[model samples]
Target: MKHAALTGISPAVIAELKNGRARTLELTSAHNIITLTEAAPGECIFVTSVNEEDLSPGDPGIMVDLLALNIGMRRIEVANSFFYEERERMSARIKVQFRGITLTRDVEGRKWGDPTKVEIVRSACYRAG
Candidate 1:
C-alpha cells in the first residue's frame, strides 16, 4: 500500500532524490520547489524527481557554461497546464537563488494512462551522463 501510494518510483530513485534534496538544501537556501506527484494510476506512471524546466523550446538550455535566464529561484512560472498550478503555488510560497535557464513547461505534467491523450517531457536524445 505504501509503495503503491507513491506510484512506480523505485527505491533507488527515491533514495537518490532524498539525497539530492538534502544536498540542495545544504548548498543553498533557495525556495524553488520541483516535486513529482502521481497524476495517474498504473503500470508505468513513473514520475521523475526533477523539475524538467527549460526555456528554449527548440534547443536544450545549454549553449555555454552559462546562459542568462531565471529559473525558479524566487518562483517558477509555466503556461503548461499540468504544471501551471504547481508552478504558481511554488512561486507564491517560496524563495531561492537562480540565474540562467528559465523554467518553461515543455510537456504535459500528468500521466494519464492513454498515451494518445498525454504528453511526456521532451527527453528523447538527451543522455543522463
Candidate 2:
C-alpha cells in the first residue's frame, strides 16, 4: 500500500506506533484538541480534532506525514483549517508540538469510558535537529 511521507519523526517512535507499543498522542491547546490514533514511518498519521468548526467542503479530516513529525521535542506543522481567510492571507500553517507527556497509569485501572490517560500540552514548534 502507498503510504504518506513522514519527516523528522524518530525511528523509535515510529516503531512504537507501528507495533502498538506507544500510547495514543493527545494534545490540547486553547483553541484545538488533537489526537493521533495511529501512525507509521511512511504512512499517513491518522488524526482527529475538536473545536475546529471551520472546514472546507469534502475535507477529509487531518492527515499528515508520519515522518514529518519531529520526535523528542520536535515540532509538527499543520495547515490551519479553522480559518480559511486568515490562512489565505498569511499563506502559512500552524506549528505545534507536544510537551510534558503523561502516559496512562495501568491497564486494569484504565476506565472503559476513558481508556488512555495520555496528556500532552501544546506549545510552539521547536527547531528540529
Let me know the TM-score candidate 2 reaches against the reference structure. 0.20
On a 0 to 100 scale, what is the lDDT of residue 82 in model 2? 75
Cα misplacement distance, residue 77 of candidate 1 (Å): 33
After superposing candidate 1 on the true structure, give the runs of residues whose Cα lies further than 4 Å from its correct spot.
Answer: 1-40, 52-106, 109-129
Q: In terms of lDDT, which candidate is strongest?
A: 2
| Candidate 2 lDDT, 1-129, residue by residue in tens | 221111223445434443333244423331221122222344433222211232222322223333433223324455566743321111112232221112111111122222121222232443232
Residues 4-112 of candidate 1: C-alpha lDDT, one tens digit per residue: 0112223454454433231121111121112212222222222222433321223212101111112333445566655554333222121112112212223332333
Give the Cα lDDT of each candidate.
0.25, 0.28
lDDT score of residue 39 within candidate 1: 20
What TM-score, computed on C-alpha atoms, does each candidate reach?
0.18, 0.20
Largest TM-score belongs to which candidate? 2
RMSD of 2: 16.7
